[model samples]
Target: MSSFTYHSLPGFGEQCCEEYGFSDACIIGDRIIVTGQTGMNPITLQTSADIGEQVAQAFENINNLIVHALGKEGHPAHHEGKSGWEHVVKLHAYFVGLSSIRDQARALMVRSIKQWCPNHQPLFTMVGIESLPFPEHHVELEVFVQARMVRFVTNESAS
Candidate 1:
C-alpha cells in the first residue's frame, strides 16, 4: 500500500475540510500537494481590499499549510522549525486581473519566493482570471513540494 499523510491547518483549514470534505494539504510518499490558497485571513475569514495585501496573504496561507504538513516534530520532513517553502518544487498563482496587476503581482511574487526560499529556486506560473471564488480575493496560490522522507509511517500511526 502507498503511504500518505493528510493535514488541515487550524482555523479555516479545519472548517473548509469539514465542510468541503477535502484536505488542505496531503503528502503522498515524498510529494506534497497543497490546495489553492486565497488571501483571506484565517481568523477573520475576510479578504483584503488591496491586491498587494491579498497576494501577500495568499502566499502566507500557502506557507502555513505547507509548514503544518511538514514541520510537525514527528513528520519525516521536519527541519528545525524552518519554513516549509524549502521543500516546494513548484508554485501556481491565479490572479483576478492579470493585465492590470501584472507588474505588482510579479514583484510581490518574486519578493515572497526570495524571502521564503532563499536557498533554492522553485518553478512558478501565474495567470489572470476573470474572478475568484471570493469577490474580494485578488489572488490564489497552490504549491507542489518534493522532500525526502527519513522515516516510515505505519497505516495505524498515520490515522
Candidate 2:
C-alpha cells in the first residue's frame, strides 16, 4: 500500500464531499492534486454564461488552490524562475461549444493565462465536447500539479 496521509479541503462541509463522492483537493506525499474548478460561485452554484469570465475564473481557481495547498496563500516566490503555474504537469481545457466559439475560447484562455500566470508554460490539451454535465457551463479546466506538503486548497465546486 502507498504511504501517505489524506484530508479534504476545509471550506465545504463533509456532506458535500460525500454527496459528490470526491474531495475538492487531496494530497499524498510530495504531490497534491486538485479537482477541476470553474467560475461558478459556490453560494449560487451557477456558472457564468460569459466565456471570458469563465476562463478567467478557471485560471484563478487553479492558481489559488495550488498556493493554498502549499501553505502559502497569495503569490509565492518562484523557484529557478518557475512559478506555481509552471509546475502544472497537465491541463485539460474542455469546451462545450467549440465549433462556434473556438477562436473566442482560445483567446479567453490565453488572456486568462497572461492575467493570472504570466510568462508561464504548461502542457495543455483542448477537448471539444457537445456539452458538459452542467448545461450552462461553457468551459472547464482540469489541472494537475506537483506540490510539497504544506496546506490544503479550499474549493467548493468546479462551477
Candidate 3:
C-alpha cells in the first residue's frame, strides 16, 4: 500500500480528527489534497454567523490550506502549484441552509474562484445541506486537485 503523509500548520490548533484521521493537509506524491474548509473566524476559531461572510471565509481558508500544503513540500505559499480548477478534477461544496441562500452562496463561490483560480476553471458540484457538523458553520467547501509534476510552480515563480 502507498503511504500518504499528512501535515499541519503551527498555532492552527489540533487536527480535526484523531487516529485514522489526518491533518487539514495531506500529500500523495506531488498532489496535495486539502480537506473541506469552513468560514470560521481565525481569532475566535468560530464559524461566522452570516452566510456571505462564511462563504468568503471558507474560500480564504481553502487558499490558506493550499498554500500551507505546498509549503510543506518545500514550495512557497500562493505558488501556482500544479493545482487549480483545471487541475482540480473534482470539487464538492456543501452549504448549510443552502435552500435559503443558494444564489448568494453561488455568487460568493464565483467571487472566490475568480480570486483564487483566475486562470483555470474546475468541475464543481454544489449541494444544499440541512446542517453541517457544527451548528455555526454556514458553508463548507472541499476540493480535489489533480495535476502533473511539471505544472507545479510557486505563484512568484510562475510570473
Candidate 4:
C-alpha cells in the first residue's frame, strides 16, 4: 500500500472536515492533491476584499502546503521551483464579482502564477459567479498539478 499523508495548513485548523468537509491537502503515493484555496488572512482567518492580494495569498498558502507535505516524506519542496504539481495542469479561478472584476482578477492571477511557477505553464479557466460557497470570500482558486518525485542525496551517501 502507498503511504498517504494529510497536512492542515498553518492558518487552517485541523477542524477542516467539521467545517468544510475537506482536508487542505492529501498525498497519495507520490502525488499530492490540494483542495480549492481562497485568499483569507492566516492570522485573522478572514477573507480579504482586495482580489489581487487574496489571489497572491492563496497561491502562497498552496505552495506552503505542498512544501510541508513533501518535507514530511523527505522530498524536495517544489517541482522545478513551482507549486501544485507541474504547471498547474488544470486551474479553475472563481470570482464573486467575476463580471465586474474579471479582467483585474485574471491579471493578478497571471502575475501570481508567473511569480510562483516560472517554468511550468498550465491550462486555466476563469469563471464569474454570483456567490461563492462562503459569503465572505470574494475569490477562490482550484488547481491541479502533476509533478515527478525527486530524491535528494549527498556525494558521500550510498545509493
Clashes of each: 0, 1, 4, 0
Model 2 TM-score (2 dp): 0.71
* lDDT by candidate, in order shown: 0.83, 0.63, 0.68, 0.70
Error of 4 at 22 (Å): 2.2
lDDT (10s digit) by residue, model 3, range 3-67: 57776544342435453355776777656787777788544687757787887777767666666
Model 2 local distance difference test score:
0.63
Model 1 TM: 0.86
In terms of lDDT, model 1 sits at 0.83
Q: Write the per-residue lDDT of candidate 1 for residues 14-114, one digit (tens) a residue.
A: 99889989888888777889988999988789878987788788878887888778765266667656677877889999988799878988998999889
Q: Estimate each model's TM-score.
A: 0.86, 0.71, 0.76, 0.77
Model 3 TM-score?
A: 0.76
Consecutive 10-residue window with the lowest summed lDDT within model 1: 72-81
Local error of candidate 3 at residue 61 (angstroms): 1.0
Most lDDT-accurate candidate: 1
Error of 2 at 113 (Å): 2.1
Error of 3 at 38 (Å): 0.6
| Model 4 lDDT per residue over 96-134, tens place | 878888678878988987787776566788898898767
The residue-by-residue lDDT of candidate 2 on 1-159, one tens digit each, is: 445433344443133577777655565555656676767654456567788878876676666556555553222332333445655766789888788998898887777666655545557788788877667787878777765313445575433
lDDT of 2 at 108: 79
Off by over 4 Å in 2: 1-15, 72-86, 148-159
Candidate 4 collision pairs: none
